[model samples]
Target: MVEQVDILVVGGGVNGVGIARDAAGRGLSVWLCERDDLAAHTSSASTKLIHGGLRYLEQFEFALVGKALAEREVLLRAAPHIIWPLRFVLPHQPHLRPAWMIRLGLFLYDHLGRGRRTLPGSRRVRFGKHVTGEPLRADFSVGFVYSDAWVQDARLVVLNAMDAARRGVHIETHTRCVSARRDGEGWTAELESRDGSRHFVKARALVNAAGPWAASFLDDVAHVKHQHSLRLIKGSHIVVPKIFEHRYAYIFQQPDRRIVFAIPYERDFTLIGTTDVEYKDDPSHPTITAEETSYLCDAANRYFKKQLTPDDVVWSYSGVRPLLQDEAGSASEVTRDYLLDIDQNGPPLLNVFGGKLTTYRKLSEEAVDKLAPLLGNHQPAWTADARPLPGGGERDIDELLADVRATRPWLPETFAWRLVHSYGTRARDLLGEADGLNALGEHFGADLYQAEVDYLVRHEWATEAEDILWRRSKLGLRVTPPDVQRLTDYLSTKR
Candidate 1:
């Protein structure tokens, strides 16, 4: 007898996991598979902001902006630890955009989609009075301060998958759906694991949420007829030493009618990014080009007093965004909005295309709302008001931090902050019955210990150093080559 499920989701990106979580919560048997580790692609390679795309307003994407804004509010409530409020300071460049236009855009952003219930509204600020202006060039006399939120993007994807697993969704990472064939009664597919183990699955419905590979999955695996096209655009980011010490992040308006952000990342570095170059290479192995690095440096240099060079870049990453093809002129101008295509002629099928990080929950809810009914699941949608994601139970993050400090005074301040912020309430479980750092286990490097690695491998499906160091956490930035080798050795035993 072959294994079967109500839904078979192909992809482990944000949308794939989001759909699994929603479907499982609504009482559906779901099985989701990913060829690589979860969020090892576009989901982890975001600009890490949970904002209504402020620049999109110029393109008149009002509906998309409002939809994203509403999702932002919901996500904040559901995952307070990994996702929290962040203020952005955009230095005024009169030539690029007028002050009134920005003010109008901010007003609309603040009030869109039920308005700013918990986050602060945007306002104009003078450079002479504000602290964020100190790092900017002397030419910027004034700027606008607005509210958005920052995310541990990869962690967001993991938490969604964990929550889905809790709700009885079967998650298979490092496993690929090699072939999927739709029979009139249901769909059957062959799954191949990384270790060469194989299995078959039958499903009542299939969802192709394969981020950058959605179209390819349809063309190759599902063998279904469809007209959707995905324009692969590569966006790259460079990490340099901390350029600004302020808590606030910067969003610089580029002369090319684009925007680049300089945000505090991993405590010690500033994250600057993102060029919209059309890409034709493999999505999995995308790396930042020298030109992209210089472009980002220049984008920051235009407004920042501390100049950046290619040598200053400590790390870099690039991800191919599989945007839904449109008639847009430039790659930068393409819509970040997603489209959910559902075909219900025989066994149901759903396809998700071209979505940004900010709107995954809404997209998932909408996807399940369409597919769940076809499988006879009449359960009402519940993820919007559902319980918080894994380890995000604590609403008052500061209070939780204070309590943890009071209880574990031996824990270093920075270490404690990282723990509380990264794992939240689950930090207690990871530190269970331990009084000192040494008890946590062998030191891998920096603050990483054997205990944390063990916890990750057991709970978060972390099988390799790359998954733990880069995706699950940014500890890769602080670790040495030998340290990585040691981690690799340890994970090899685990796998």
Candidate 2:
């Protein structure tokens, strides 16, 4: 039997789920399918920041910067549990960029976006007296501090899918849209699950939110013609032991004019990234090259008093960015802004191209706005003024954390903090009627108990151990291999 819906969204990344949530909330019947887990690819492999690309100012992308800056506050309000303010320290480098230039750019970043509240503006700091100066090389005496936000990137994607599901959208993870054909007034799509089961759907409209695979999906999967082109760039990051003792992150200016960041990660480690190299390989499973690893270490070594080598890297990840093709000399210079192409030659098909995490909500809002009218639905834009995403109703995260700890006095401080930051009010739901740690369920490793694991499987569509350890939470940094095997065995039995 072929099920029918008003819209069928292909891809489960940020934009895909974001659109699903927006469309479903507007009373449209929405169905979304992903070839792998939610955020299994590019969406999860971000530098994990929500900011008004300070560097984009150099590229003269003022419009993009302004749009992103506005979304920063909206996202913080939407998901305070996973998104919060972060201060970035930029050590002075007179030889690379002048102080005046930096100041001018920051001034625009502060004032360009509307509804900028809660976050402080940029200011200069003395490395000799400030806590951010403790780990920098002695040569750096003055620097600038700016505000941005950090996010659990993968969790952000899942939460959008969760919100969409709650609003009556059908979310199918581990399901692939094998073929989509426009027939008469709508589309007939064949979807295949990982277990080799196939299902069919008929929809009034189709949305292609495939990120890195957007273009190829048009050619190979959908077999459609398009005038759009994508420039694939590989960006890689490395995680090492904490390089600094402070809570502040560092943004270093390289001689090549690109910037690298060393941010706090997983409580005990430091995250450094991102080299932009032109890529021409399969987007799936792009591994970090040794040269890329050395590049990140050298970038950090240039700024920190403590030197680093490739051997110091505890973990690494890489992703291919499907940037909109433009006349640019370098990969890093390609536009981070996105484009929405609506092919109205047949039944309306919207193709999403070239977006960063900071502007996903806005991109989604626009995508739905364009399509909703085409489908004869006149729902006004509502996501901006909507309530926070599930588990994010509480505005003050610190107060929520304290309340959880107060209610569950037996919960350890670190464990309680993790839960509150990861789930906000939903942490209590995970605890249920449990009175103590033992009642929570069997301890797999670290702070992970069976209760949380079961909650992930039941509520968040988690299937694999990596989904729990790496994506849902960064517990992979602490969980033993034996513990992972135990979790895998348990999941197998549940299946």
Candidate 3:
């Protein structure tokens, strides 16, 4: 039997989840399928920022920069828990991009966005005055400070999915769309979930919002032939112990003209990343090589006071950026902007190629708007300046912390801060009626409360322990081997 729906979204990445949320909110019966866990792919493995790409301006991608900048504030308000304002210090070097040019880029970055709030505008910083410059070499006497927002990329995707589900969308995790065939006036698709259950669904319209798998999904549609290509470029990031003093991040210019980000991750570690190289391997299995690790470490050592080795790495991950090939010479130069191709002839398939975490919401809105005419009906775009996600409750962080302390004064100040960072306004929901630390239940070591673990499994669709330990929260770093085994064994019993 085939279950019918108004719309079907392929792939479970950020773009697909964002589109699903938008379509479902508009009162459409939306069904979404992912072959793996939500954000088990590239969506989770990002440098984890929601800022306008400052480096894009060097490529003269003003329009893209402008769109990303505008979305920054929207996202911050939408998910303030996970997305918070961050300062970046670009240390000046003589051989790198000229200072005047860098200043010009910052100028455009500051003015491009529409609604700007707590984020401070760009300004010059004296190397000696600011702590951010402490880790820099002696010769680097100047720098510029600018604003951006950090995001929990995995949570962002999960929150979008959760919101979509709340709005009556049927989300099938661990499910893959095996086949799609044209029916009388719609399409019939078969989905096979991980539980060995096969289900069929019919939809009026299909969206190939599959990130790296867009092309393959397109091929599944009979008679919808096109020559559009996406270049799969793999980017990797490494997490190491904190190497800098200040909260501000660093954007270092490499000799090859590539820029790398050294951002403060969590509170104890630093997240340095992202090398853009052509990937010919499977998108699902993109792995970081020895060379890639060395490259990133080398880049970090070049600009910082201390030289880092691979031994310092505590965690690492890699993801493929599905880039629309526009004939760029270098992978680093490929457009971070997205492209949409709507097939009106054979059947409706909106193919999304190339997008960033910062731009997913806007991209989804545009995609839904494009589909409105094709579906023979339309709804006004609503995600603009809209809230996403869970955890980003309306209450300000200060008040929320004060309230938590009022209720549970025995809770460690540091742990309370962690709760605020993780759950934002929803911290109370996670903590519940707990009066003290012990009431929070079993601790899997280092702030890993039983309540949080349960919340993740029940709400966030976390089936595995690693999802809780590593991706959803970085408690895995602090938890011991026996503690990890305990959590792992407990989750196995649940399944």
Candidate 4:
């Protein structure tokens, strides 16, 4: 028997999963497929920020910034465990940008989209009086502080997929939509699974939320023609040993007018990123260039009292952004806004172009709001005020940690903290009836044990060690090689 759905969404990135979740909530039968693991590419490689893009103000992207600013709180409310408030310290550089300009940007950031009500407002801090300033160079005395939120990027993608599944959306990971064609009144597509098997799917409407592969998916897979094109821009980041002891993150302005962010990551390291370079290669396996490594190091060196080099980098990653093509002078100047163009010449077809992770919910809401009416389904737009993601029920992670400890006092203090922040209230579900650390089963490494692995595989679609280590959790940073091999062997048995 051939399978069918109301909407068939391709690509399992943030935008793809977000769209699937929204469509499913609106009472639509949806099916989403990804060639690889969810968030295997660009979505997982983000700078991991839920910000208003403070730099975009120079580009006069007020509308985009406002749109993103509004979603910050909405996402925070939905997933407080993975999304929490973070303050940024920007050391003043009178030569690069004046104080008044920075203040104006902060003011607009504060007021735009009613950005800061729950989080603290922006303020100026003196290095002499503030603890955050002590790590900076002596010459750097004062700077501005602002509010933004951090996200567990890959987990955000998975949570959306999980929510969609709960609402009856069929999710197929490690499955590729090899061919899609408009057939009869709807669309017929072929999906190929990982073990060399094929399945046919029919859908009333097709959605192309393929991220960097969006343009190519239209050209090659669907064999559809359109005027839209994507300019692939590569952004890279470097992780080094902890640069600062505080919880505060820093956004540095470079001489070239672009910015670099050094954020606290995995509790033991500083995550510094993101050099934007023009890219024309395959987007699947983008690696950080040596020059980008130096650029990020130099960018950080200019602000901090401590100096760093390429050797200091413990790990690095890169993602190719499919920014909508425009007549911009440089890659940095290209707009980060997204476009949704629905082709209705044959069956109703929706193609999602460039978008940032910050505005994915709004993008999904708008995408479905446009596509739903065409399919004779006028379910009111939901998800904005809807239920929270799987583990997001508890807003106070500290309290959740306290509660988990109260019940499972045998669990290490640090171990309990990791579980609560990673899985929220569902941490208890992962714990099951385990009474002690040994009962959680064989230890893979660090605090990771068999019970957590089983829960991830059964619930979160983790099929491999890398999926658990890198994407599902950043435990890759702490686990040893022998332990990873042990995990790989164990997962092989489960598969």
lDDT scores of the candidates, listed in order: 0.92, 0.93, 0.85, 0.93
lDDT of 1 by residue, 1-495 (tens): 688899999999999999999999999999999999999999999899898899899999999999999989999999998999999998988888998999999999999896547998888899989999899899888999999999999999999999999999999999999999888689998999998999999999999999889988889988888989999999999999999888899999998989999999988999998899999988989998888999999999999999989999999999999998999999999899989999776898899989999999999999999998898889999998888999889999999999888999999999889988889999999888889999999898999999999999999989999999999899999999999999999889987
Residue range with the least summed lDDT across 10 consecutive positions in model 3: 216-225
Better of 2 and 4 by lDDT: 4
Candidate 2 lDDT over residue span 1-495, tens digit each: 999999999999999999999999899999999999899999888999999999999999999999998999999999999999999999989999999999998889888785747799999999889998888889999999999999999999999999999999999988999999999899999999989999999999999999999998899888999999999999999999998888888888999999999999988999998999999999989999999999999999998889999999999999888899999999999999999999998899999999999899999999999999989999988898789988999999999999999989999999999999999899999999899999989889999999999999999989999889988998998989999999999887765
| Residue 344 of model 4, lDDT score | 95
Point out where model 1 deviates above 4 Å: none
Q: For candidate 3, what is the lDDT?
A: 0.85
lDDT of 4 by residue, 1-495 (tens): 688889999999999999999999989999999999999999999999999999999999999999889999899998899899999999999999999999999999998898446888899999899988877889999999999999999999999999999999999999999999999999999999999899999999999999999999999999999999999999999999998899999999999999999999988899998999999999999999889999999999998888999999999989999999999999999999999999998888999999999999999999999999999999998898887899999778888899999999899988898888889999999998999988999999999999999999998889999999999988888899999999999999997
| Deviation of model 2 at 410, angstroms | 1.5
Residue 110 shift from truth in candidate 4, angstroms: 0.1
Query: Which scores higher on lDDT, 1 or 2?
Result: 2
lDDT of 3 by residue, 1-495 (tens): 778988889888899999989988787889999888888888988899998899988888989989999899888878877788898888888677788998888898899865665678999999898888789878789989999998888888988988899999898888898887667777788899898899899998888877887887767643357788899999999989999767889988899999899999878989998999999888988888899999999999988888899999998889999988887899999999998778766457777888999999999999888986677667788887566467676647778788887888888988898888777777888888888778978788888878888888888788787788766877777889999888887777666
What TM-score number comes out for model 4? Answer: 0.99
The alpha-carbon lDDT assigned to residue 240 of candidate 2 equals 94
Question: What's the residue-level lDDT of 400 in candidate 4?
Answer: 89
Backbone atom clashes (below 3 Å) for every candidate: 0, 0, 0, 0
> Model 3, residue 59: displacement in angstroms?
1.2
Which residue pairs in candidate 3 collide? none
TM-score of 3: 0.96
